[model samples]
Target: MTAEQQTLLEKSYKDFTRNGALLSDEAKEELRKIDAALAVVKLKFGENVLAETQAYQLHLTDAADLSGLPEGTIEAAHDLAKSLDKEGWIFTLDYPSYIPFVTYADKRELRKEIALAAGRKAFQANEHNNEKNVLEIVNLRHQRAQLLGYSSHANFILEERMAQRPEKVNAFLQDLLDKAKPAALKEFQELQDFAKKLDGIEQLEKWDSAYYAEKLKQQKFDLDDEKLKPYFNLAYVLAGAFDVAKQLYGLSFTEVDTIDKYHEDVQTFEVRDENDAFVAIFYADFFPRKGKRNGAWMTSYKPQYWKDGQEERPHVSIVCNFTKPTASRPSLLTFNEVTTLFHEFGHALHGILADTTYPTLSGTSVFWDFVELPSQIMENWCYEEACLANFAKHYETAEVIPMALVDKIKESASFQEGMATLRQISFGLLDMGWHGANPSLIEKVKDFERTQFASTSLYPDVADNAMSTSFSHIFDGGYSSGYYSYKWAEVLDADAFDFFKQEGIFNRAIGEKFKTNILAKGGTEHPMVLYKRFRGQEPRVEPLLKRAGLL
Candidate 1:
């Protein structure tokens, strides 16, 4: 946390505790001040992140230097070049730039070079390194939670989350690990054997993971991301999202050219209700840059809140680092990227469609476990044929995605899902290892990370590659011990979407039930209560396991 953030958090705690508002004008005023202070903390934190982050970007000149880049990437480079003063191209630390370079770049040494460079963030001997920020954040969080009368940061965050206690979180993570570790080990062994056969490599290095995984995928499934990307262009995917939102709810989006944005690529839109009343403002920042983080997330300029009487519509933004379109071709996406866009947009919908009395109870302000239900449930639509037809058009050919291709997507959906589940469980466990218990003994961070990941190791651990240094989800973002929310939410989303599958994806009654019971209710009730209202029974892991072929 920054100085400003700390100051505000202190004020909020002091004012809230002193006032102790069960109900009164002074109490209301104090609570409002607390709310306003939290808003400031949110904005300043986001601004510092964006400003400090955008304060740097790795630039390159000479078109030949771009030899390792995909053709579409080169075009994005040109776009960045034009934005900056560069003559040839500019690439940022965005995932679009870094991920492709690691997975597909022919230059092995450059891939390792950048891979290590990217991971050392907030820890490297520079201002960009975040070691102090991370440590202070954990300590401050622990302090704040203790003020609220909790033992640690995890206890504070888990109050409303589905995994209500640290013990529950530990049990949930360990149970999944117990199921997934063997499968992950088997998968790693198979990949090692495959790599040895393909290149006579005695040792499988960290850099070799994605490159070989892609090859193994193609050999096993007769399909690869490069082949599927052409069918999942950016524009059609956006249109598909619009269609889904429209069908499920009565919302419509109008692409408006009437507002200011932080970036050139960020297109703005006016969202409306079925009656065409103005609803919300949407912003889409879809390309990578040095100034931006390396993942997709939904943020808000204004939150939907009702105070006294008037309702304030939110300004929601979905930011991601997807591949850029070349002059020769429009922006095409790998299937993973396609699902990511939908997931973030679902978060946007939760914010935009928010109809609540207080900003505190507004969209996605619910329990950590339930928040991802809307987002992840949206991704399930990506695998549906009817959903694909609504978007999924070839940029050049203007043809809908082929049925055969969709079949491949569904068939491969569960491929190596056990390995994937294990990976998530490992991260969740690592998170627990950090905050669910006393991390004060962890004088050195890397040593602690090694113990946490020892059960989940596939490739040899690199001394330079530390997840703690760049783990924005825990260190910087509000996740902390809640990083397990991803897996926890997966259980909820799969079970919730299974309800959707049973009734109908676009069934108005079920959709309304979701909007009313899940999305609209927000933090008013326990997440499981809201979920059981929608699902009729307690959520089970079997649907998730069945989806992942773990069953």
Candidate 2:
């Protein structure tokens, strides 16, 4: 082997040993059993959550109870009820149906009902309760860590992450908490006062938060999502995202009918380089249905790699539970959904442009915190006027979004910056609290979460609702202690985009440098080394703070 290859193999050997390959045969056997059991438990945990989610449905026979919900939401709900041979409207815990009801519905009691139903998923006394599953999962994780001679699960995982150790992750979360607390408190007070004046809301309950926040936002900025959705038809926004990629990377996408798709809702495309060479296969799946989970994300069917003296391309897919089109309208996306599309597409670009050799270390195989930079940075373009002008045209009139509305959108970007930052910091802290130290003492899930979330608490605690029960990120998914990566990557993205702003949003030379240095490099080297080679320096928090209006 070459010297570099030999060195990498040596490091890999050390990694395997440190990760438990060096354990005694008996200990390794125990670990294998623990892993098998834990896998089943984790699968059960996720399935229970989904079952609990699908189990509940609110059937509203009174239009009065549906007051303040948008026309589109009502139509969808009506369609749902009709499909079930029921009357009036039906709203479930699905985000597309649930978010609008909780955010815009004026019926405080019903909103509380919906919110509690959501938060109470897998928490109640039922076949799908996750309380026991959570306890067993954590215990098994701690046992596995101990078998491997690690202090905690976080300590075991952080060894491979940029943060390196739990102490560093703790310090990082604490620092952000310290900075965000003051502003968060102020924002909470203002929101409470606004709620009181607007609706005589006495307590500002958990359910009241989103409803009032939306009202206050509209009152302050004279803007709401419904007013913005008409300009963000899914087809046009997809084209716009593609255009942005083409502008930045000299890539082109052509829809192809021959490519096989796992689902009919999925669209397939052939991606090509500037010289018209085949690059990657892209698949997009939008809209939600039964047997499908909620939310949005990017995934890969095949990894890019070099084998047998040839480079094998990748197949990338982005899946989202966007609002489905109805008889009256196309699938018009909220501004938040627009940014989500850009974020996932950014990850797609990372996969599409991967120029690495090893499949295990290729395309988004970088440190968890560093993996979000490309994705989060793409969100910035959604706010740019030129970017918006390219595709934010009304579906009916074909007129571009008014500059006035764009100004409102930009102005509202940081409307509740303080509260939002604190919410994120709270999640990161909660994650650390769970995984960074001994969690064997956490007897009751809700009580433990209350203690961890004490300082960051904004809304009044609901007796029946708990976040940990449904927090699939740490339990069923890979995030575990790495939820803080979202904030960490925000800092990187904010600083990186500041560079783009200094040059120009679509500057070709700068884009090429970013592509060659960051996007194409993947996990071939240390993430910090690759990042510094791209940015010419370490990232700065000042840029993120400034963009968040927290500075």
Candidate 3:
């Protein structure tokens, strides 16, 4: 235990020095002040974004305004309006309300209005605007990087990631861009042409993309999210994930109501090994609420570690905002939400399986680029017929998802994958453009973004809209120069899952190897070494490219 403590202390001290602790006493004092100010500024930046998101609302009294929205969406909107003591539907910037409207609403003008509102979230001239905040945040980051003897923020951040420098990150993104751009352009042209044919619209704008793409997908695959939702009820999907975990790792989960929960929607469970020994505590919070933030993520309240000759267990939680259960139905998840649950459950499994000696080096503390491999790889299971057979059944009828629908899901897995890859690459490139070089001379955020996006730009630009102002991942979150890691980890995940595919998907030996080698080991060694130890070879990009149909 003492040795373990010593190791953690050493790592913490090294990290502090690597950040800026070796500076002169005066410089160190200034660094402290800068960090304190940065904390306040970042907090304010996120708060401003949330406030702005909550502040805007499109209150509708006419049925025509709600045209083309899903029935579930209309019901939710009516509930919101009733709660607010209004007469008709109310739509906010929340994704549940916003996404369906943009994707299915027939009123292009309304879609344009909501999309423009979403895009220009913190870019407005109101008190919640983030223009000055963005400038100050980036300048402070650059200043901190220089103070730490790095040329730029990307250089400082990438030092600890799989991609070790700005140039390498840029090259990785560009290589993917070169492969994906042609296909992406062709896909865009097809989408535009489809919109023209379907609605007599001459040009398809950004707001029209999802609506048309969804329509086109239905036309091609004869599969839609609503048609698939009945088989993915939230409770059953959670059970499916647990079953997969059990089959893969010999773990079991049982709901225990005695544990205190933070919210009514949260479910608590006791995890156990095959021997019935306690493993970890898992909490799941699904469904959207006003207080909780958007997006799904896994977090650990107590990390698994060893001390005093005893192994402590972990408490892991997965939070998400799925479509809430309406008055007439259970909480049925869209196909995308099913994959999301699996993704986050994968992260929780990482925490639950942690067997490290030191808390600091425990689960999910690996390299930024490597941390996503487990989560993303788990998503692959959702597309498998073997896995889906366990828990994918209709909420009312109890009928399993048809083999035909499963086949369609697999067939359409890589549909328009090139365009999707290009979109992710664009975000990564934009992140690099901000942090890879000096942003000292960039006055207008939109002007700088236009240049960064020049290579990836497809549709006509919206003058009032800017992405940088609300790009929380790079600015307020830990992804500053690390957005590319999503793609970076995709490569790792594709390669890793290929191993499972080689052996049977449910091969116990392979599952045990993965749990012990990758999830349990955490940040104990360099990520590349850990990954190679598990896979027995360096990962090849061909697997990822092939999976995405880029090959």
Candidate 4:
């Protein structure tokens, strides 16, 4: 058998044995019950979070309450109210609504109200509360891990991951925390001082963080999302992403009419190589509706594999919840949304470029910690002048973005990065707190979370807010004990992008090396081995630290 086939077989065997294939029938029955209960509880946890998110709406009858909002945000809110048969504007906890309101809204009380509402999702005294669900999830996970002969759920999950142990994950997080905490404290203090000087505020609350930070960023860098949005119309940004793929990987995307789509909002494309050979089918869903969940992600409808001596291409999709275009304007993306588009498109490219034999080992089927490298690395391009020159054009005037603004975008890239790193570390530590040890004794989810967040706490704690209750990444989704993978992959992405910088952002040689050694290779080999083949060495943490401005 080929080495790839041997690796697949050995992995399959390990998966079975690790999942209790060798257990007695009675033990297996227990495992079955645990799995079944976990599925129900996890679904319930996500449903409750979504339902709670959908249930709340800050309805405003007076236009005075809409002070400090962007014109587009107000228009979107007005349209939402019109749809609901209401007289005034409406804003929900959805990111598209909530983010702009908090960051740009003038009314401090209103921002506080919405921010608190957002933080209290699934944590309130309501039918949708997830405290019990959180407790049950951790307890059941711990029980399952023990039953599977592991010390903890984290241990069981990490066994197949690049980290391979809870200790290493903890040490990695702690090392970052140690480097980041001092910087975060300084940044927090600076933000507080800035807020106080600007508004005569003695105390800076959670809601004030984004508002003041954005204000300070504008003050220091002369940049803000509002200034950059006109140049980042969604369609243009996507086309730019396609162009990047074309320039780097010889891929072309053409929208096709023959493909049946689940929704009219979804755009279907036939992806092909430079030689016009079929690569993959791509679908992009770029709006939010009544039933859609929040956030953006890339998913696969079909996997690429060799079958019957023929190559079966993959079907890939990227879904996002960008603000819809209003009647007066096109759908303009915030700078962050631009990066999000590139990130998901990067994942789509991974799936589209897969060249593996076994379906299980195909695109994005590698270590959990390694999966974010492609996505995160792609985000780096959004900040590059060479790349942004292709897509960053004003929708109204067709004007290319000024190099000055591009410089500002690059300058402000590390704005509040210290606090951001600390925030991520807090989540990683919280994940370990739940799964790295026995969670059966965790009596109160909020209390447990508070303990875990002790080292990373910035603002005063909100009595009504508990992040774990709605942290679906660990409870409802597949993160479980793997939330640290985001930072873990950042290390890889920053280092890998450094290599691209030394070569050239659009250097085809480096791009082909990345496509062959990483994206196309998938799970056929160890992630480090593949990464080394592309990068020529193990990744260095210094690159990530330098990028984050935490060094």
Off by over 4 Å in 1: 1-69, 74-92, 307-309
Q: What RMSD, rounded to one decimal, does every model reach?
A: 6.2, 1.4, 1.7, 0.8
Range of the 10 consecutive residues with the lowest summed lDDT in candidate 1: 2-11
RMSD of 3: 1.7
If ranked by TM-score, best first, what sequence of candidates would result?
Answer: 4, 2, 3, 1
lDDT score, candidate 4: 0.94
> Per-residue alpha-carbon lDDT of model 1 for 46-150, expressed as tens digits?
444454345445566655556646666667768778877778876555677666666766556656666666655544555455444445555555545554567
lDDT score at residue 356, model 1, on the 0-100 scale: 67
Weakest lDDT window of 10 consecutive positions for candidate 3: 1-10
lDDT of candidates 1 onward, in order: 0.76, 0.90, 0.89, 0.94
Candidate 2 clashing pairs? none
Model 1 alpha-carbon miss at residue 195, Å: 1.2
For model 3, what is the error of residue 341's alpha carbon versus the real structure, in angstroms, after optimal superposition?
1.2
Which scores higher on lDDT, 1 or 3? 3
Ranking by lDDT: 4, 2, 3, 1
Instruction: Enumerate residue pairs that collide in model 1.
Output: 54-291, 92-290, 122-129, 122-130, 123-129
Put down candidate 2 lDDT per residue, 1-551, tens digits, no spaces: 74335535755786787657989999988988999999999999999988988888999998899889989899999999999999999999999899999999998989999999999999999889999999898889888888888899898888778888989888888888888888888988999999999888777888988888888899999999989999999999999999999999999999999999888889999999999999999999998899888788889899899999999999999999888889999998889999999999999999999987777767887778889999999999999999999999999999999999999999999888889988998889888888888888889999998998998999888889988888898899889889999999998999999999999999998899899888988777777887888889999999999988888
TM-score of each: 0.86, 0.98, 0.97, 0.99
* Best prediction by lDDT: 4
| Candidate 3 C-alpha lDDT tens digits along 1-551 | 45436557766887988767789998898788889888988888888888888888988899988777778889988999999999999988887788888888889998898999999889998888888888888888888888888999899899888899999999999999999999899989999899999999897899998899889999999988878889998999999999989998999999999998989999999999999999999999997887677788899999998989999999999998888888888888888889999999999998999988878899888889999988999999999999999889998899999989999999889888989999999999999998888889989999988999999988899988999888888888889999999999999999999999999889999999899889888777778888998999999899999998888
- Clash count in backbone of candidate 2: 0
**Model 4 bad stretches (over 4 Å):** none
